[model samples]
Target: MTDVEAQQAHWAATFAAHPEMYGGQPSAPGAYAVELFVREGCRTVLELGAGQGRDTLAFLRAGLRVTALDYAAEALAGIEQSAGADAERLATVAADVRRPLPLPDASVDAVYSHMLLNMALTTPELEALAAEIRRVLRPGGLHVYTVRHTGDAHCGAGTALGDGMFENGGFVVHFFDRALVDRLATGCTLLDLTPFEEGDLPRRLWRVTLRREGP
Candidate 1:
């Protein structure tokens, strides 16, 4: 398999192995941060690399329209299952963020991702994803995301897969430093950035919120 295909397979297996690794509860710091920063509206929201529909379901529950995109078929399937066949508010697409996402330009009111940017990708690939994100967001749109901080203990502890790739139980993670993320998101205005702890977990993480540059 190619590099992207290999990465996709790894995540597919990871999701299948531990479907509940992220916990069934709707409580990730990134999700909470996005909801807090972005307003609730009738317009649509796009969530890239959505895994198991955690953020998508949460937003749908809050009465927001959401389109959840991921490259792995298993991930999208799991999201549908989690939605229990009644979640008409959520739409699913199996697509990669590094390439052209399925949506058209300026089609979304907001874009949100969680632990999506740092996974098994080089700086160039991340930059491409950032550009695609910029293309799809409408003017004044908000972007919220969290990246695995490079110094997090679970990274490179010999138990890790290799290089910047590591397995967090059922989820494979890619670690990043702040400088790298800023470089990837070169053209956007990083409105606010703050470090947050998840469920009192002992790890350093960042919540980054940005606005699309005005036309």
Candidate 2:
């Protein structure tokens, strides 16, 4: 199989193995980010790579309408099972975010992504995804995201080579430092980026909140 197809298969297995990870019941940082967004008044949200609706459920429970987007059918099934009738509050779609975001311009009030950008794209693909995000988000819409921040220690199935690249589950993961992210968000107005500890791990994380330029 091609790289994209192999990557998709990997995530499908990962999500299937751990459905609860994406079912709105995260233990720490993930939960914190989701709670903060809704508390800050993100009413209509779209989550890219929303595996099994974890953050999506959090938003819905907080009275925010959500659209959960993931490419894995198994992941969506798990989300549906966990959400039950409340699932109606969510619109689940299967699409690759690296391509054109399957929505009209300025369609969503906010975009929330977690751990999605780290694995799914090359530098060029990331640029395209950022552009798509800019296109789909309403003027002044918020973009809340967390990506793998640069630090020490090996985690996941990946071993760090001499450089910043890692091989986790046989897929290459590019860890981003703060400067890298700032460059990527050049077009968007950055609101805030706070670094925080994740769980009992020594690794660092960036909680970024950006806004699409207002009309």
Candidate 3:
């Protein structure tokens, strides 16, 4: 199988085996995004990697319309099922984020993703994804995404896959450096870059916030 295809299969199997692999609770970044979105009066959110719908549920409970996108169809189904009373305010899409997002221009109030930007995608693909995020966001709309940075404990660990990506424990991660973060900020105004930690391994990450500019 191709590298991307293989990674997809791995994630599918991993999700099936673990069910709520990352737990059912919202992530720190997810919770933060909800608070920020609320304060910004964001009515709709498009989450790039809504694994198990943890953050998806958070947005729903906060009364924000959410569209959760992931490559795994089963995960999307699980989100819809788990949505329960919030299902009406939730939408799910199963597609690769590396490609163009299936949304019209200036469609969403905000975009959020937790660790989705650091997946097996290449640098060029990441730039494209950022552009796609810009296209879907209305003027002054916000985009918040987190990524493991080069300072992470496992940044250079395990198999090297080139372009800052490494495969350790069967999962590929693209460890970002500031230069890359700057490069991807093209066509958008970089708002915030916060360094943080997560999990037992204490993965080092950067929570990046960007704002789309009007033409």
Candidate 4:
């Protein structure tokens, strides 16, 4: 199988084995994204890589309509189960973000993702995904994502997967630097990029927020 296929399989198995791998609590970045969504009066949100529906639950609890997408079917299943009564407000889709998103143009008020952009995607793939994100977001819509920066402890510690990517524990990650972050924002106006830490190891991350212009 190709590298992408291998990565996909690995993620599927990983999520199947550990449905709540990241637990139910939303990440700090995700909470902050939700705050921005509320402040911007965003009612519809598209959540990419919605593992275990952690952030999806948070968004639903905030009374926002969320379209959650994840490559792993098991993850989506977990999301659906966790949504329960709030399932009416959540739509789950199984999709790989490296390809064109299965969403309509200007369909969502905001896009939120946590640590999804820093996956095993190449630079070109990242650019394409960014363009698709811009296409799906309405005018003045926000795109908030987080990535492990080059300064992270695991930046170059794992087996090399080419294109600044590394594979560890059957998972591949592409560490991002400032230049890569800038390249990924080709189609949007980057509003803010700040550093933050999370988890027991205190993983260093770059929380990036962008806006699709033209109202």
Clashes of each: 0, 2, 0, 0
Compare the candidates by lDDT and give the number of the best one. 3
Q: Estimate, for each residue in 32-149, the C-alpha lDDT of model 4 and write its tens digit.
A: 9889999999999999988778899999988899999988887888788888899999899999887899999999999999988877889888888999999999999999999998
Q: Which stretches of candidate 2 lie over 4 Å from their true place?
A: 21-24, 27-30, 33-36, 155-164, 169-171, 199-202
TM for every model, in the order presented, reads: 0.84, 0.86, 0.97, 0.95
Q: Report the alpha-carbon TM-score of model 4 versus the true structure.
A: 0.95
Model 3: CA > 4 A from native: none
Local accuracy by lDDT, each model: 0.75, 0.74, 0.92, 0.88
Model 2: per-residue lDDT, tens digit, 1-215?
75556778887877667755533575354566567666666677888887767676777777777788888877777777777667778888899877798889998888988778777466777778888998888988888888777763443346764334577656666677777788778668998887766555555677788988966
Error of 4 at 43 (Å): 0.8
What does the lDDT read for residue 213 in candidate 4? Answer: 88
Error of 4 at 134 (Å): 0.2
Q: State each model's C-alpha RMSD to the native.
A: 3.0, 2.8, 0.9, 1.4
lDDT per residue as tens, model 1, 1-215 = 76666778877787888988877666465456446644544367888888877778777766677888898877887788788644787789888776778789988888888877867776677778888888888877878888878777777654476546776654556777778768766667888888866645566678788888866
Ten residues in a row with the worst lDDT in model 4?
A: 11-20
